[model samples]
Target: MRLLFLTNRANALRARISNTFTLPERFKGTVVEKWAKYWTGLVRDYKDVGVDVVKFGYNKPRKALVITGASLGLYACVKRNPDEEVFLQLLRQWNNKLILVSPTEQNVIAKEYVRDLELVLNRNTLRTLSLGFCTLLWVDLYSKDDCTYKAICEYTGVDYLKFYQYIIDIGFWNRYWRLDWKMRNFDINYL
Candidate 1:
């Protein structure tokens, strides 16, 4: 069972899998440590249940994409048959550097990630990404000013004052010690 991710060194977007998470900014003291322990424990819950969570990041195939002739041929096949497995199989042939999770877990994990990430990400995006993985996938709000941050919080469906600590903790999603989430934010960036 394996989960595959397309990534590049210069830009590790966290991609669609993490789109549902609300990652936190750098924080102080033991704040992050506590949150990390909580997040780790949460993930451990599923692993103990026989779920092997493996996320493999493979660089986008630069040479193949640049070669117009081959790309066209590949594109045609994908267009003709829109099966996801076909696309995944082609991906496997393109890169030898990979760590495959059990394919059996793909659908199940993708689904469970939505429910479980709600707890881990603990913050929702204004809506599902309109562009999905096509856009930059920063999980945390980058606004520095209060007003701007407030607007972002609005879209994320969190009350600024209420989630302030959870949003800016040294740990992104602190479950214990930090204040409890009043509204219970949820995200699916890792699915």
Candidate 2:
């Protein structure tokens, strides 16, 4: 989920959500509602895939993703480099993930990430809403065979048998791979 720019989506992912998904529902017949209705299905797709969005989880795999995903940012921040785009992007991704998991997860977004988010939202309703929306979209489009997926698996030190079992239990992994997915049905032991 932390992989930057997960999909092009014709560069419309921002418009699809900030312009609609995260907004409170309007009248049923309103144009916004219609657009939101269409996005609801797609947005929901990413959330169910189960990848750790950015770096928000309290588990090993999640922590690994954060460490690996934000490595560049962390390095840049520590070095006090003049250009900290990677570090800034890391903050934005982490902060956005926090928004989606909030009310239980404490928000740790620094002033910088807030400014970055504000710049993206352009003074729209609730920056948190857009952050949450973007977070879901990032995870939604993740595929098991993608290079990012391999990196996460390598970092997580995934047990093929167990990971495959988890996918089967959940009605097939959110996204399949070229390798055979046949696995005996069994209870999952996920991290």
Candidate 3:
């Protein structure tokens, strides 16, 4: 079987392996070169195990696709809109296996991917709900700050009036947005 590995960042392979494995002192190079050598070694190992390895990025191959990265990379592949015909075509042709190797929990990744799928499947309704939630959060926290709201509106391309209407219609007063609860609790230095 053909094996293809996809990662959001090139260093993902190194990061994943470095946690449990030690590199030999003979493997001397810059960080990028070391990673490249490590990746090649991995491919060679797979080859010894009787798996046909396919190169990605340089030449596009029509075979089984292995995507190994952060959840965001998988999200991008699976979340393409119907209008993205070429992407859809490529997706359809491959037997795609996603390998998410990030610090984030698998369940969280799955949940977010599913949520994105839901948004794509029901674009109008889900998009409105998502935008409404974001808009409400921005309004609730930064209403007094003109620059923040202006930047938010500009970034999202959401009209202030429409967002207000959504909030009103959704009964913002009755519902808690939980913006603070969703904040990343862990320190970045730990990662």
Candidate 4:
């Protein structure tokens, strides 16, 4: 499988539980220490926990894909890169799996993904509601209410946030990967 790290900052790979995952602080050597440790630890973590995302295709090989973005780019990563045809073509060239790791939301958008999502909703809601609606749709469409999600609800009692967190941290995904630290420094640009 191939690993894809898509985010605005490459530094995210080193984030820990409480780190902000932004530029190095540059004070008292905080950024340097964090960066060095983050990279080293991540290499170890990926080796241990099986990485956050893995790509699986026709069972040939494995590869890695990493993308960085500030605001709007994050959105494109998830909603389907605007030049999806090109991306799809590129993805097909590799025998390895396609793993994509990105923040849950994006900053700027072309509105096409949103429009398509709106068509799926049964009611007349603003585009902003699409995120929640999509989450619901995923839960329903995946029948997660009865499977893993149900288990999450039964145990955590925190609803989707916890469920989503669980999935992100589950160490099963290979393509779409997100460093746990990105949750903190997430900008409101695309999301």
Candidate 5:
């Protein structure tokens, strides 16, 4: 199945540890092996489930898309939209899905993103966009920050964290992973 995994790029706005220190400056005099390993671990998790994960660079298409950042990566994909059909095509899949594994902190741009998406994308399409290709809404989020998390809950009205707990209760991820993997083999237009 085709899957798109979008996460924060190191060059993203928050690349710096904070305003007080830049990313490079923060990592100065230290090896980045552990940092690399953390991302590698996320990739390995997908690999463990037999889903291929890409780093949001390069020009390749997967059967499913899994984006993890609420900042730039999410903004870029949403801005590109169905015109960037390669990604949109994957997003259009019945089992096509999106996941926002974002930091709790709010960025000004992200606030605007939520507003823009709500204004432009129709409820059905937004729900469909939230759902994968299966004619259902299937968006999910994993966040620890309360303010932004609360904002997401208010916007989607899904009580994301609670929903996630329920998913865990039902083993949702594993089942969805398998279902999506099977769904990935079909044509994008097959419906």
Candidate 6:
């Protein structure tokens, strides 16, 4: 499966994915070794699991997209930041499946960001642009110790019960390495 990883910063999520899976030898030297060197670039022939890494500010085309630190991107775009166009373009091109990964703190920030954007743009335009992907999945990477279904509902705008159904909690990273397993088992039928 071809995977495109979109992040707000360099090596943030790529480092995690690299740690979880064993990349091929070519990628070991070019991508795995020089990951820090690239803010946005393609890692071709990433073993049997094809993977590409790109930062949010970069203007690159991708099919199936996995957005890590999605809340940060949303915040930037909503605030009319430097990369707003890039973010809009990325969202416009997202026709295939999309997975958005964010921590609790960022998710809250994104909720506020979206609220502000709603005031600036037409509701339909914002909704169609942001929530128009074929298969959109929101994955919460971090939750508070006392986090509950209601908390997630307030934070994500998803219904309390539907929040559990849609969001993929790979568990805390400190608990164990679960991203690889979840990613491997991810249903890519939309792709």
Question: All candidates' lDDT scores?
Answer: 0.36, 0.39, 0.38, 0.34, 0.38, 0.37
The TM-score obtained by model 2 is 0.18
RMSD of each: 28.3, 27.5, 23.1, 22.5, 22.2, 23.5
Which residue runs does candidate 4 get wrong by more than 4 Å? Answer: 1-34, 51-128, 132-191
Residue-level lDDT tens digits of model 6 in 1-191: 11233323335666777687765667776765677435324442342132233322244544224354565565554454223244344333321212333233233433333344334343222221123212122433233332656545656454557655543212221111222232342333322
RMSD of 5: 22.2
Query: Alpha carbon lDDT of residue 164, candidate 4?
Result: 48
Candidate 4 TM-score over all chains jointly: 0.17
- Residue 152 alpha-carbon offset, candidate 1, angstroms: 5.4
Better of 2 and 5 by lDDT: 2
Per-candidate count of clashing residue pairs (backbone under 3 Å): 14, 1, 0, 31, 19, 0
In TM-score terms, candidate 3 sits at 0.16
lDDT of 4 by residue, 59-163 (tens): 333333223233445554445422323322323432121112233432223233333333433332211112311211121222223355644555544355554
Task: Compare candidates 1 and 3 on TM-score and give the better one.
Answer: 1
Residue 137 of model 2 has an lDDT of 12
1-191: candidate 3 lDDT, tens digit per residue:
12334433424664776676765566556686678777879875765454323344235443323344444554553353222233233223221222232335333533344344334434322222333212222223223233655546645555666765433212122232231222123112232
TM per candidate = 0.17, 0.18, 0.16, 0.17, 0.16, 0.15
Best candidate according to lDDT:
2
Better of 4 and 6 by lDDT: 6
Give lDDT tens digits, candidate 5, residues 1-191. Answer: 12332233332433454354534656755667567557657865765454333423233433223333445565654453332223234434432232231223333333333344344334322332323222223333433232465545657556645654323111122132323444343332221
**After best superposition, candidate 4 residue 191: deviation in angstroms?**
50
Candidate that beats the other on TM-score, 4 or 5, i.e. the better one: 4
Question: Native-vs-model 1 lDDT?
Answer: 0.36
Model 2 Cα displacement at 85 (Å)?
Answer: 17
Taking all chains together, the TM-score of candidate 5 against the true structure is 0.16
Model 1, range 59-145, lDDT digits (tens) per residue? 344553566567686555444532323323433432221123343433443334333434333444312111211211223443333
